[model samples]
Target: MNNISNKIKLRREQLNFSQEYIAEHLGISQPAYVKIEKGVTKLDFERLLKISEILEIDINELLEKQYIVNNFKNSDSSTAIGMVENLHQENQKTNELLIQTLFSQISDLKEENKRLISILEKLSSNK
Candidate 1:
C-alpha cells in the first residue's frame, strides 16, 4: 500500500511466505488477504488474533497511539518515525566509531591496491 504499510507487508514477506499462504493459515480467502494488504478492508477479530499469533505482534499495534490498552499504548506512524529517528540519532557516536573503522579499511585497501598496481606494472613491463 504505502511505505509504512509496505514495511508491515515486507515483514510478512520476510519469512518467504505468500499472501495466499497466510490467508490459508488464517482460514480466510486469498481475496481477503489481498484486501488486507491493500488496506481496503479492516482486519477482523479472528484474523487480527491469528495475525498477532502468527506474526508474534501485539494487538495494540493495529490501533492508534492514543488508545491505550492494558497499560500499553500503540505507536502511530509519526510516533514510530520519530522513535526510529531518535534511535538513529542516538547512534551518531557509534557512527563516528564506524567512520574510524571505515577509514582504517580504506587505508588498508589503498596499500593493497598499490601492491596490486605495482605487480600489474611489473607484469606489463615484462610483457
Candidate 2:
C-alpha cells in the first residue's frame, strides 16, 4: 500500500500536477486525495484506473510493486528519467533503421525502372 502511494505521489509530482487538480479529476476532496497518497485510504480499481489515465501512465506501471519500490526508493527521479531516455534512444534507432530500409527499397525500385525503360527503348528502336 505504501509503495503504491509513493508511486502515485512520485508520478504526480513528475508531471507537475497539483493534488487539487488530481482531486478535481477524481471528484474527490483534496484531503481525500492526500489520504490516498499518504496510504491512509485504499483506492478502488476504478479510481486507480482513472488516476492512471489522468497521469498519462499505464495501469501496470502504477500497480507494479517491484518497479515502484526500485524507482521510488529514496525518491530518486534520475532512474526513471534515465529509463525514459533509453527508451527514446531505442525508438530513434528503430526509426532510423526503418527509414534506411525504405530508402534502399526506393533506390532499388528506381534502378529497376531505369533498366525497364532502357529495354523498352531498345525494343522500340529495333522495330
Candidate 3:
C-alpha cells in the first residue's frame, strides 16, 4: 500500500476536520470514514475525489509518491533526513525539466510568429 490513508488522516488533522465532518460529506457513518482513513477500507474514485475536495487538495497531491516519501519516518534520524534530501533532489530535477520544456515551447512560438510576420510583410509590400 502507498500509505495514502495516513496522508489523508494527516491532512484531515491539519485542516481540523473531525471524522464526523468527513463522514457527513461522504454520506457514511463516522466509523466507516474512520476505516477509510485507517486503511481498513479501500476508497473508490468518486469517494477519493470527494475526500480530496474536502481536504482542499488536488487529487494528484493526495496520490503523489513524493508526498508519501516526504512523510516517511524512520527511527534513525539520519536515514529519514537522507530520504527527504533525495526526494528534494528529484523534485529539483523535475522542476528543471519543466522549465526547459517551457523555454523550448516559447522559442518555438516565437519562431512561428516571426515566420507569420514575414509572410504578412511580403504580402503588404506586394500590395
Candidate 4:
C-alpha cells in the first residue's frame, strides 16, 4: 500500500471511525472507501481534501509520509512538520498548474467545436 493510504487508515482507526461512516460522508460505497484505504483506488486532490476534512485533521497530516507523522511526538517533530509543509506546498503548486493546463485545453476544444459546427452549417447550406 502507498504510505499515504496507510496514514489515512491509521488516522481513521485512531478516530474510531468506521469505513461505512466515512463512505456515507463522502457519498461513496463502503467498498469504494475500502479500496481507497487499500490504495486500490487512486485519490484525486478533491477526494483527498474531503478525506482530510472528514478525518478532522489538517490536510498536511494526510499529505505527510507515515514515518514523518509517526515521529511527530519526538524531538524531530519540527523537521517532520516542515517537510510535510514543503510537500503540501509543492503539491498545491502542481495542482494549480494542472488546473490551468486543463482549462486551456478545454478552451481550445471549445473553439474547435465551434469551428466544426460552423463548417457543418455551411455544408448543409450548400447542399
Candidate 5:
C-alpha cells in the first residue's frame, strides 16, 4: 500500500478499529473505507483531517512527517516521552548531515567557479 494508506491502516489496526467503524464515522460505506486503506481512494485534506481525528493521531503522523504511532499502545508516559526524544535526536542528526553535505557541495562549486574564471583570464590574456 502507499505510505499514507499504510499509515492509516496501521493506525486503525492499532486502535482496534474496523473498516466499518471508520466508514461509519466518515459517513461512507465500508467498501469506501477499505478502498482508502488499500490505496485506491485519494484522501482530500478535510477527509484526512477527519480520519486523523478519529484515529486520535496528528495529521503529520499520517503524512509520514512525524512518527509517534509506535508509542500509541504504550501506557507508560516515560516510555512514550523517551521514544519521542529519540526520534527528535535522530531527526537532528539527519539534518546536521544534510547541512554538512550541502556545505561541501557549495564549496566544491565555488572552487570550480574560481578555476573556470582563471581559465577565462588566461584565454583573455592570450588574446
Candidate 6:
C-alpha cells in the first residue's frame, strides 16, 4: 500500500472512527471511502477537499516532513543502520495498530512540547 494511504488508514483507526462516519462526513459512499483509504483509487480534488474538511486537518499535515521525521525519530535505534531497521519495524507496528487518526496523538505531543519549550524559555530568562 502507498505510505500516504497507510498513514490515512492509521489515523482513521486511531480515532476509533468508523468508515461510515467518515463516509457520511465526506458525503461519499463507504465503498468509495474505503477505496480512498486503501489507495486503490486516486484521491481526486473533490475527495481531498472533503477529506480536509472532515479530518479537520490541513492538507499540509497529510504531507508534512515533520510528521515523517517524528515517526522516524520515535523508531528506536542503536546506529544509522539500526535506525533504518527500527523505522521499518515501527512502520509495520503502526500498520498493525488499526490506527485511525494520528491528529490526537500528534496534537497532544505538540502541545506538550510547546509547554516544555515555554518552560525552558522562562527558566533561561530567569538567569
lDDT of 5 at 18: 91
What's each prediction's TM-score?
Answer: 0.41, 0.52, 0.52, 0.55, 0.51, 0.47
- Give the C-alpha miss distance for residue 125 in model 4, angstroms: 31
- Model 5 lDDT, residue 22, Cα: 96
Instruction: Judge candidate 3 at residue 52 and give its lDDT.
Output: 97
In the range 41-67, model 2's lDDT, one tens digit per residue, is 866556777999999999777655353
Root-mean-square deviation of each candidate, in angstroms?
A: 15.5, 16.0, 10.6, 7.2, 13.0, 15.2
Give the per-residue lDDT of model 6 (tens digit) for 34-94: 9888878766444665676676667655543233456556554555467566557645654
Ordered from best to worst lDDT, the candidate numbers read: 4, 5, 2, 3, 6, 1
lDDT tens per residue, model 5, 1-127: 5667888999999999999999999999999999999988866656887999999999877764455575567558887787678657755654564566678778999999999999999999999
Write down the TM-score for model 4. 0.55
Candidate 2 Cα errors over 4 Å, as ranges: 67-127
Better of 3 and 5 by lDDT: 5
Q: Where is model 6 more than 4 Å wrong at Cα?
A: 65-127
Question: TM-score ranking from best to worst?
Answer: 4, 3, 2, 5, 6, 1
Candidate 3 residue-wise lDDT at 123: 98
lDDT of 2 at 86: 64
Best candidate, TM-score-wise?
A: 4
After superposition, which runs of candidate 3 have C-alpha atoms over 4 Å from their true positions?
67-127
Model 4 misplacement above 4 A? 66-127
Prediction 4 global C-alpha lDDT: 0.81
